[model samples]
Target: MNEQALSVREAIIGRRSVKNFNGQPVDLENINSILEDARWAPTHGLRNPWRFIVAANKEYIKFQDVLKEYGVPKWKELSEEELEKQMKKFRTPGAVVFVVVQEDARQKERLEDYAAASALIQNAMLLAWDQGIGTCWKTPPFIDNPKFREELGVKPGERIMSMLQFGYYDDIPKGRVRTPLEDVVTYYGIEENGEEK
Candidate 1:
């Protein structure tokens, strides 16, 4: 656990998606703690639609072989140097989490489930940041492949929503500016002529 505690606003504003990890193994206990708290995220109909498949510590090493197969296609043909360079992305992360969500038969329920899972992901990211851990939510095309789904043991009637990576980083990436509310929002029923626009 980190000695310092950040306020919710600080965690939301300061957190950055870290792509450069230091390769230190993230404790499974810590990841569990984050998820335990994060599971409180809002879910429609009180259905907690998300679950995770995690690979950490020694397991991550084994996962590397799987990554080579899917993450880097034709990896065997590449030179040692080239393969190492390509594998760096997979190697650096201390842990990998595959977020899975139920795919309800009804369209509305399916969309709601996805939304709930997204909220859960955001909650986990914020919690991780507060603990001095960084996270990245990824959705690579391979996640949808049947082979990859089998590798993760994702069952039918469910979807892999995110490939979340958790790790430590030496640098705090600078935050980018977001679009101002004035540009992205419009007040309802507000007009110069006092008519709805």
Candidate 2:
């Protein structure tokens, strides 16, 4: 690769997930920039069904409480250490971006919208990375918790695709080794002798 391309590669490759955060607060401007860039991301039908729930205010606390009250097993039985751990989870970071998918038109349903929204989120992830911010795209425990979403005032027709969290480094996380592309991709071609070798 040329120097220009190499620099781009360096930025992309340097992006890492940071779970630990300091007391620094992420301003609304940067978060807005990330979301604004995300709006331009392509979608198949151009319905642009991606909506966001900004969980930066008291809403975050409300969501946390709802998650606890909803009885997630991990949160249900909390020793002092465990309770502290859970409380500290979101204490530091800047903002929690909930990527919610609005219901689809044409009866395609909301699932397709979520698929498209996930693409928008990738745009967001890269944007955050380019801006020297940390992110963790949480799902399952967070996404599947409807009670928590409701606390964030997510409307009835919406569901989560992913969450694009943003903050400065709590701790610089180590990047993991990615699997080689060759192992995951294949070219459809006949073997040398037309045998299945």
Candidate 3:
């Protein structure tokens, strides 16, 4: 389906974290379109701090190798077969995007940058979903490790926010339950003492 055919509400409410991919290659053009949509996400002061490192096709092999090497410290206790099984999971996605954000020295600016990058990720995910693609955004501890970050080409001033796995999937996951709006929202502006009018 074309991205324009999907409404914002459908994209927001229907998208799910897809774990199983059909193992088909997604076109580079579609991937670029998703990133372009992400580029339009709002940012404070127009910092446009988001950066992406995409791994696809033959690059996925190198990505899997890096995952295996970096994951060693965290998975030291696992058997070799177990480690291989885990690493194999990385191969299922058609592509993986490492989302990075440039950090600012000022705390508020840094926070805003992070928030903007998060919005960018959401935009990309929804855009992909609109095009009949699936995505999973993850923040594995190993990706933040110094050595791993260096291997992944993450610069000194940039922070990895998410590893977005994109692919085509045969399954459409059922919607998960969300907290009710009444339980999470509160309306004020009534009387003194913060009581509703």
- Name the best candidate (by TM-score): 1
What's the lDDT for residue 44 in model 2?
A: 68
lDDT-superior candidate, 1 or 2: 1
Candidate 1, residue 135: the lDDT equals 99
Tell me each candidate's TM-score. 0.94, 0.76, 0.89
Q: Sort all candidates by TM-score, best to worst.
A: 1, 3, 2
Worst 10 residues of 3 by lDDT: 185-194
> Model 2: per-residue lDDT, tens digit, 1-197?
11122244775687787778774667777787778877877776788887787765455555556545643457656897887676675666677787877776546645666667877787777777777778888775756666666767787777776766677884678989999996786556756455565
lDDT per model, in order? 0.92, 0.70, 0.85
Q: What is the lDDT of residue 183 in candidate 3?
A: 75
Clashes of 1: 0
Candidate 1 stretches greater than 4 Å from native: 1-4, 192-197
Top lDDT model: 1
The residue pairs that clash in candidate 3, if any, are none
Worst 10 residues of 2 by lDDT: 1-10
- Model 1 C-alpha lDDT per residue in residues 131-172, reported as the tens digit of each score: 999999999899999999998899999899999999999999
Residue 61 of model 1, lDDT score? 84
